[model samples]
Target: MGFVPSQDADKIADTVEPLAERLSEVLGVDIQAQVLVDYTGLVEG
Candidate 1:
């Protein structure tokens, strides 16, 4: 997930983590919520 540069990192985590948890349950696998630093970071990931 990508957030605006000014958005708080914790806010991003709050929004994404829950979804990740739900997905992990449904998929029966670990799902990490990775917040991208930038487009380059996403590409590298």
Candidate 2:
């Protein structure tokens, strides 16, 4: 997932990672999440 303003990336990851872990536990599957901040905005561009 992408966050506007970039700085929120860490905060977003902090929140998401735990949820991903919980989902993995409940589903008995490996759920992974990597929150990357695109400073260059190349993805959007």
Encode model 2's per-residue lDDT on 9-41: one tens digit a residue: 678788888888998999999987666547566
Which residue pairs collide, candidate 2? Answer: none
Q: What's model 2's lDDT at 24?
A: 90
Worst 10 residues of 2 by lDDT: 1-10
* TM-score, one value per model: 0.73, 0.61
Query: Which portions of model 2 show Cα errors greater than 4 Å?
Result: 1-7, 38-45
TM-score, cand. 1 vs. native: 0.73
Best by TM-score: 1
What RMSD does model 1 have?
2.5
Rate residue 12 of model 2 by lDDT.
Answer: 78
- Model 1: ten consecutive residues of lowest lDDT: 1-10
List model 1 lDDT by residue over 1-45, tens digit each: 344334776788788889999999999998888777776776777
